[model samples]
Target: MTNDPLSPQSNDSQKRLMVALALSFAATAAYTFFFAPKPQPPGAEGADAGVVLAQGADAGTAEVAVPPPGNGGTAESTLTAEAPPPPLRKVDVARQEAKYTFSSEGAGLTFAELQGRKMREQQTLTIREGFDKLFGKPVPTAPQMNLAHPVPGQPLPLSISIEGNTPLPATTRYAVEEGTTPKGAGTLSFTGRQGPWEVTKSFLWPHEGFELVYTVTVRNTSAQPQSGELRVHYSRAIDPEFEHAPSFFGGVGNLSRSACWIDDKLHKLSPGDKPPEDTRGQVSFFGIDQQYFLSALYPLDGPMAGHCVLTATPTAREVAAGFPLNVGPGQTATFRFGGYLGPKDPDLLRTVPGVALRDAAGLSTAAAFHPKLEDTVDFGIWAVICKMLLAVMKFFHGLVGNWGVAIILLTVLVKLVLLPLTYRSMVSMEQVKKLQPRLEEIKKKFADDRERQNLETMKLYQEAKVNPLGGCLPMLIQMPVWIALFTSLRNSFDIYGEPFFGPVWTDLTYKDPTYILPLALGVSMIITQKMQPQMMDAQQAKMMTWVLPVIFTFTLLQYPAGLSLYIFTNNVLSIAQQYGLRKWLARKGGNPTGDGTAAVSAAGGKRK
Candidate 1:
C-alpha cells in the first residue's frame, strides 16, 4: 500500500485539524448568533399599549360624584355640571443640561427643551408639540393629566380621581408656593383643600440630575378618619408624525413604547384600538417612552401594588398610575414617587439607585443596577455583546474626543484582534481552492465506487493540509462583532444629534438623507467579496457576489448612519488585509497549484 499520506506522526495534519475544529466552533457560534429573529420596530404591532382592560362598565363602578368648582354647586348637577376651568399657572425649571416648563392646570409637565441639543438643520430638539401637525390643521393642545371625567359610557377609564367620601372639585385651582430644597434645588408646591381633607403636591427638581422627586400628602383636618385614592395621571399622543420620522435613529414611532416593570421583568403594554382598560399589579416603574427619552413613575421605597390605566382618543394615548392614601383623624399619608423625564443614557440610568438588582441563581451574579430601567435603551438579543462593545467604543471615544473617529478606531481594534485567525482561514481556503481540480479528478476515477471516492477525497485533503470549512469560517467568526457594533451604535445616546463629516453625514443616529453611506457600503461589500478566494461552485459564488450586496444595501438604507459607517470601514479593512495576505503567501513559495509536493519542492530549491 502507498505510505499513509496522513500518518499519525504528521504534526502538520494535527495543526490543520486543530485549526479546523476551532473554525467549526466559530461557525456554530455564528449560527446561534443569527438564529434570533430580526428585531421588530417598537410599537410596530399596534398603537395601543398591549394590555387591554374593560373600561366602560368597570370604570363606572369606581366613579364617584362630586360638586363642580366655583360657588356652591351640587353633585346632582350631572346634566349641566360644567365646572369652570382652573386658572393656568406656568413654572419654569432649569438645570445645566435641560429646561422644563410645567403648567398648574393638571400639575403636569408641558414641555422640555434640551439645553444644547440641536437637529441636523440647527433647530432645537424640543418636546413641546404634543402631536405632529396632521391633515391641514395644527396639532391639538391639551394638558398631560387633564382632571376631567370621561364622557359617561365612554370606554376609556379616567386616570384622575379622588376616591372616597370627600371628592375634590374637578375645577379646583391649587394655591402655588415656590421655594428651594435643602440641597439648593428648586421646589414647587400646589396645595388645595376640599371639605375636611387637605391635599398638597410638591415637586423637587434637582440642581444637576435627570430625574425629579414628586410627593403628594393627604391629611385629615377634621375629627373623623378619611380615606381616598390620589391618581397621578399621564398621557401623550402617539403621534404618527413621529413614527418613522427621519430625525431619530430607528425612526420616531419605531422606539415609542408603553410598559411597566412587573415581578422584576418588563411587560410591554400594547396600544389598543378601543379605549384603554385598567390593569392592576405590583409595579415598580410604569410609563411611556420614546427612543432616547422616557417619562416613567418609580416608587422610591419599593414595589407598590397599584392600578395602571391606558386610555386613547383618535389623536392621543394616555397612561397613568394610581396611589392609594388613607389617613386617621390626625395622621397624614405621604406617598413619595420618582419621575424620570430624561435621556435613557445607561450611565445616567445606572445612577438611579436600585435600577439594577443582583441575582445569584443566574449565569451572571451581577444584578442590573437600576432594575429594568436600562432596558429603555432596547439592546436586542445579543445584549451582553452590545454592552461590552459600547464600553470599548466609549473608551476609544475618550481618547479621540470625537464619536465618529472613535467608531473607526473601534473597528480597527476588532480587526486587529481577529487578524491571526483570519490569516489562517484565508490560507486554508486558498489551499482548498487549489485542490478543486484534483478533487474533480478523483470523482471521475471512482465514478462507480462511492466509498472509494469518499476515502480518496479524505486522503487528498489530508495530504494537502486543507480544511474544507476554512473559506467561510472567518466570516462567521466576525458576525457577532458586527451585530454587536450595529446594535450599540444604533442605540447609543451619545451619537444622537451628533454630526460627522460635515453636512453630508450630519447626525450619526439618523439615516443619511443623501443615501451615500449605504451605497458606499454596498460597493465596498462587493469589492471585499470579490477579493476573497472562492470555495463554492461557480453558480453559487456568482449568485452570492451579486445578491448579498444588494440585499445589504437596501437593508441598511434605513439604518442609522453610524452603523453603516462601521460596516463600510470594516469591509475596507478586510479588503486591505486579504490583498496583503495573498502577497505574503506567494512570497513564502506556497503552491498556487493543487499539488502540495510542488510547493515543498519550490521551497527546497534555494537550499539545494
Candidate 2:
C-alpha cells in the first residue's frame, strides 16, 4: 500500500528511471496497438497473402487472371482479344471444408466410424476411406475416404477384395473357416488351389493387452502346384498431401511440413518418388496440438502407447524393414505382425507382444544446454533441484481443482516454506543497506584506489556477516521451477481455453487479446522490484528498476496469460512476505527503522 516502494524510483536516481520506463511503455503500446498490422478478415479477396484474386457477391465463380489463349500466364493479357467470360466455376467453399476426412481405412478392414483429433503438428491419423472392393485392380485410385466419427454398435463399412493378381479360379467356391484361438483373430477358408485356401484376417478391435497374429494357408488344387510371387502389399490410402512426407507422419517443429511414416522413419511423401510430381501423400500435421502426441512421436516404439505423452518431430532418415517372407503353395508361410492406430499409451503398448515400439513417451528429446557454459555453470544442479520443487508444486496441484488457484497457493506455500531463508537474506540485505553510508564514506576516503575500496567492501561484508549472493540464491533457486512450470502450462492441453476469472486469462498457451493480465503483471513487477532495497550503482539500479518490468511486460504480452498471472501473483505475494519479514527483523534489531524501506535488521542483510 505504501507509495514509496511503489514509486517509479526512490532515494536513488528516480526521475531518469521514470522517464525511461514511461517512454518504453509508450513505445511498446504504440507498436502493439497502432503500428502492428491486424489479422486479415476471413474469406476477404486477396487475403491469402494475395493468393486469392477476387470474391463474388454470389457463390458463383469469380474471374481470376489467367494467361491468354496461347500463352501460359497468370496475368491478364491486355494485348490478346477479349475472350468470352470463362464459364463460371461454382466454388463451394463450405462444401469443400466439410467434404474430406483426412484418413483412409486399410484394405479388408471395416471401419464403423472414424474420429480424428489433432495431437500436434505432425502426427494426425484419421479414418479417411472405408469400403468393400473387388481387388482386381486394387480398386483403381481407391475409394473415397470418410471422416464421420465412429459410433459403437454400428456396423463398420467393409473393405472387400474379390480380384487380385492371384485370385480364386472361376470354378472355385469359398466356404468360411472361423478360428476361435485368438480373440478377433479369425480365418476363413476358400475351396480352390488343391484343397482349402485359408484367408486369415480380423475385423474386430484387438483385445486389450493382446496382439493379433494371422497365418494364411494356400493349398494346391491341381496335382501339380504352381509357383508364383505372392506379392503382399500393405495398402493404406492416406491423405497424399496430408503431411507432405508419408514416412514422417508427424511434421517437424511447430510449423512442420506434411509428413509420411514409412517403416519407422517420418518423411514428406510427394506425388513422385523422384521429381516433377508434387502431389504429397502426406497432409500437413502443422496444427494438431496435443501434448501426448508431441511427446510420444519420438522414440515411438515404447511401453507408453495410449498414454498422454508429447509427440516429437520425426526425423527424415529412412527406417529399416524386416526381412521379406517366402510363401509356397500347399505349405503356408505365416507372416505375423501388429500395429497401433490411436494415441500412444505406454501401458497398452507394453502389454502387446511384438509391438513394444509404441511405448516411447516423456520429454527427453529436447537437447539440454546453455549458450554459454560460464553463464550457466550450475544449471544441471539447479534443474534437478527445481524439478523437485515443481514436484512439490504438483503435489499441491493434485489437491486443488483449479490450476490458477494452485499456482497462487503454490507461491504462498513456497513463500511460507522459504520464510526463514528469505528472512536471513533480507537481514543481510538490511545490514548492507545500513552500512551503505559507511561504504560510501570508505569509497570517498579511498576514491583514488579501486582495489582498496573493494577490500574495504569485503571487510564490511565480513564484519556484517552479509553474503552478497544471499539475496540472489533463493531467487536463483526458483528459476528452474519457473521454467518447467511455464513449459508444462504452455504445452499442457488441460489448460487450453481453461478460464480463470473472466476472459482476462482463458488460455494458458495464448495471450489475452485484451492484454489486461500483462498490464497488471507489469505493474506488479514494477512495485515488487521497488520494494527490494537497491544494491547496484544508482544509475544501474534506476535503469534496471524500470527496464526489467518493461521487458517482462513485452515478453508477457504474447505469452500464455496464465504465466503472467503467476508472475503477478508472485510479485504481490513477495511484497507481503518482504513487509512481514522486515517488521519481524526490525523487532529483532535487524532493522532499526521498523519500516521495510529503511535500513534495519541484518538477519537478512545485503551481501557485502
**Cα lDDT listed for each candidate:** 0.63, 0.41
lDDT of 1 by residue, 1-608 (tens): 33566775576677899999999999998877987566567535443323322255323222222333343433343212122333568778766756666656545555555544431112112123211221122433222322112223221211234666776543345567898755567788877655555667887766666566677777765555667776766555544544433332233234355566766566555445455667777778877665666667777666787776765554454666776767786578887676676667778776664221111111133432244577778887989998888788789878877778878888898889989888878778777677667767777899999999989887767655577777677679778987787667667677666766753454676666566788999999999888887866688788778898998898777676788888899899999999999998888766534455464334334223
In model 1, which regions exceed 4 Å deviation? 1-86, 118-160, 164-172, 221-224, 245-253, 270-279, 310-317, 329-331, 353-372, 440-465, 591-608
C-alpha lDDT (0 to 100) for residue 98 of candidate 1: 62
lDDT of 2 by residue, 221-293 (tens): 2222334332221122234333343122122112222222322223432233332112222211111112222
Best by TM-score: 1
Instruction: At residue 490, give the lDDT of candidate 2.
Output: 40
Candidate 2's C-alpha runs over 4 A off are: 1-291, 294-398, 490-499, 591-608
Q: Specify the poorest-scoring 10-residue window by lDDT in model 1.
A: 354-363
